[model samples]
Target: MEKKPFFQGLTKKTIALALAVILWAFTNFELDVERDVRIPLHLSGLPEDLIIVNNAPENVDLSLRGARNLLSSFAFSNKSIPVDLQKTERGVLKIDLKRAASQIVPRGIDIVAARPSKLSLNIDMLVTKRFKVKPVLGEPDSGYEISKKLKIVPQFVKVKGPASQLGKLESIETAKIKLEGEKAEFTAPVQLQLPSQYMEVLEGDHVNVTVYIKEIILSKEFRDVDIVPRNFGELEYTTTPELKATLVFNGPYKTINDLTSNDVKVFIDGAEMGESRVKRLRVKVQYPNSDLLKLTKTSPTSVRVRVKPPPPEESPET
Candidate 1:
């Protein structure tokens, strides 16, 4: 019986295999390596009374140095840097990003360097403010008008946002409501338009808006309206002044805009004249659609009329 040597069968092939394994270990596990890894930045512990107004980095780049295997595993792992803002106050805050990077680093891996070693943050106080709700509207049909007094169910709304931003806000407008071809009053539910991205509607997000629509009223002046003499016989007669009148008409927009001087008439009634050679005659006006149209004013409301005396031609002819 014989005892086998501890290094029995140590051939050239075996020696080469051992060396290859050792080199792989040094390259992957024992030797130190550097790598740049990007990890998410988690923000927590922020005071409820404060808000961040500036653009903050969502992820930070970390230069890590450690064994190749460890760093590779850590880089691929789901890990984030947790930032605690429990002691933060309203204003600009400078943060040490290196400290944050070191906190979440694994036990073996070392943080060689961190991009953006510091962060400049803009903070503001959280506040609630009330603002008037302005209703937005589109153009109505032609010859129609919308009332100036818009009825909103909740006239005012309360919003919570950064104090600095809220200071510049005047009024919040509602989602645009179209009044195109609208002929009558209507009520609709409308969403509000937030002025700032950081603002949240705490009281009223949607409101009921009552829009009033009516036919537009307009005034038109008809110049140089003819004033004719009515019931005047063949006898010669003359008026104190050239018979011309001006009229101002008030009515619906469509009717007034379409009306013309020909649609109206003015006349002096000679039948109502007295025996006086010279007499004052009152002028009268007439027009179609009087129910919807009204004659607001008439220039030269009265005129003087004279009857010419006939010549004594009968005695001369005889």
Candidate 2:
């Protein structure tokens, strides 16, 4: 073997080499540092649905650890790493380090800051209301039937946002709640998908809507019979919802449609019918003008008329 001193010197050189390599690695590597960030004020980029009343971690502390050269040049004041409020809403927006990063940041540095150092975003006032929702349809495949009726859970909901945006928002709707004429039920979120520039919707993610479907039936018939005045004396001419009596009919659906309401009529006979009394009764049908499904049945198929006696000869001359 070679002399011991020679090996010892070689061993020392080897150790030095390893330490130099390790130091180089540390110089190349970066450590996370906490940075304090501050935003001047709310900007115009925020969404209408969200009111960024406060900034999260108002004063953000980001941890950055990187090459000494890079760290030496890094300064929190150099650039504006804004707290993007355009997409934020009235609710709390947690700090997102992924975006807090800037071009100056190197790969080695890490982000380590207070969970929420500063902020008291005061979201503006928002008001929501109930609105009518209409459904639209697209061409559907053959043979399937869709339910025409739509059921809105809670029927309505409230939407709150900036007054300006709220005014333009005539409605909050979904992506066409369509069943494609498949004759089934449909449920989805009431996604108020606004343009990118628009504010984020802080309301619940989805709305509850229900639709029922049933096969169409074509076997019913209907008819209209003349309406007769009822208790006319009891009603003053000015009274609203004038009361009327009419003959109610029930029979073959086809036959009912074949007859007209005018064809059925109620008339009074002059056979010395007593006052406050009526006798002539008949059924007359006439042309129809409405689509009230069917007049399945009528109440008081008949009526008893009472006539008030002539006022006793006006009280003797004053």
Candidate 3:
């Protein structure tokens, strides 16, 4: 049998198909398409002791012109523009985005424009400082008081932040531990309160706080405490119905048990009388242990005071 020519088996349809494929490739490769790509801006080569203090753009819109096929391949892929700050000083520094983009982009792709042509970076030295942790507490229930100081585990924490901002910080506070209506010993874990966004707790962020609450002893009721005159050396002053008051106070059990009527002084100020014949005055309580004792109630908050002039002076003239 005679060998058929090499082109004898080639079909017209196959030739047309090959030509179409070649034409498609030529068009896609030679023609250019415009596309907008969002690329991330990566900061690198920064020392461990330095941080960016200002808000900088993390991503930039890059307008690129390239072949359609090439552009489509980078649709979902992110291109990074690296910013080197290894040799930079601590201050505001400007980076040229155009120059950075040119170095990273492939040869076929042209960077038409960047939305933000320049990036402004504010750098600061990071500093680690110690701060005392203060526990925040709320008011306890009535007749109850915090008997002991709030105890916190790891009373202090190390914080890192911009040196300028951290210099003024002396102490850090914990999240509020509510003691409202709390009457017993309580313990809880609380988070540290950071002063600013630039500040961070380098050590443990949480602390354990213990609170001690104690109930006050039963209040003592003293009947008929004598009311003394105040600032009445020359003027004789008298209160109607023999001024007396019932006093109720609360304190430690031993303190309240030892308290006597003589330990409390109830009086009305003479200066408050003015010239009125019948003047209403507020009753004030004075005690040696006023700081430790809490006055709960007074029978009559105010009293009617009457001022009188001595009438026996006329006998000296005779």
* lDDT for position 23 in model 1: 94
Ten contiguous residues minimizing lDDT sum, candidate 1 = 1-10
Best by lDDT: 1
**Model 2, C-alpha of 201: deviation from truth (Å):** 4.8
TM-scores for the candidates: 0.78, 0.30, 0.60
Question: Which is superior by TM-score, 2 or 3?
Answer: 3
Off by over 4 Å in 1: 1-11, 30-36, 112-117, 136-148, 168-170, 175-184, 213-216, 231-236, 269-282, 302-318
In terms of lDDT, which candidate is stronger, 2 or 3? 3
**Candidate 2, residues 1-318: lDDT per residue as tens digits?**
568775778978999999999898776544442334442222347654445433334244455545565566666565544665666566555544435554335555554443343444555545554444433444433434454676665444455445456666655565555556555555554544442233444545455666554433222333333354433444322211323444444433344455554544443322323342434332223334324333444433443333444556756776
Ranking the candidates on TM-score from highest down gives 1, 3, 2
Model 3 misplaced regions, further than 4 Å: 1-26, 29-32, 69-78, 216-318
Candidate with the greatest TM-score versus the true structure = 1
Q: Write the per-residue lDDT of candidate 1 for residues 173-281, one digit (tens) a residue.
A: 9989999988889999999999778899997589999999999999998778789999988767888667889899899889889888887889998887767778888
Clashing pairs in 3: none
Candidate 1, residue 240: the lDDT equals 62
The global Cα lDDT (0 to 1) of model 2 is 0.47
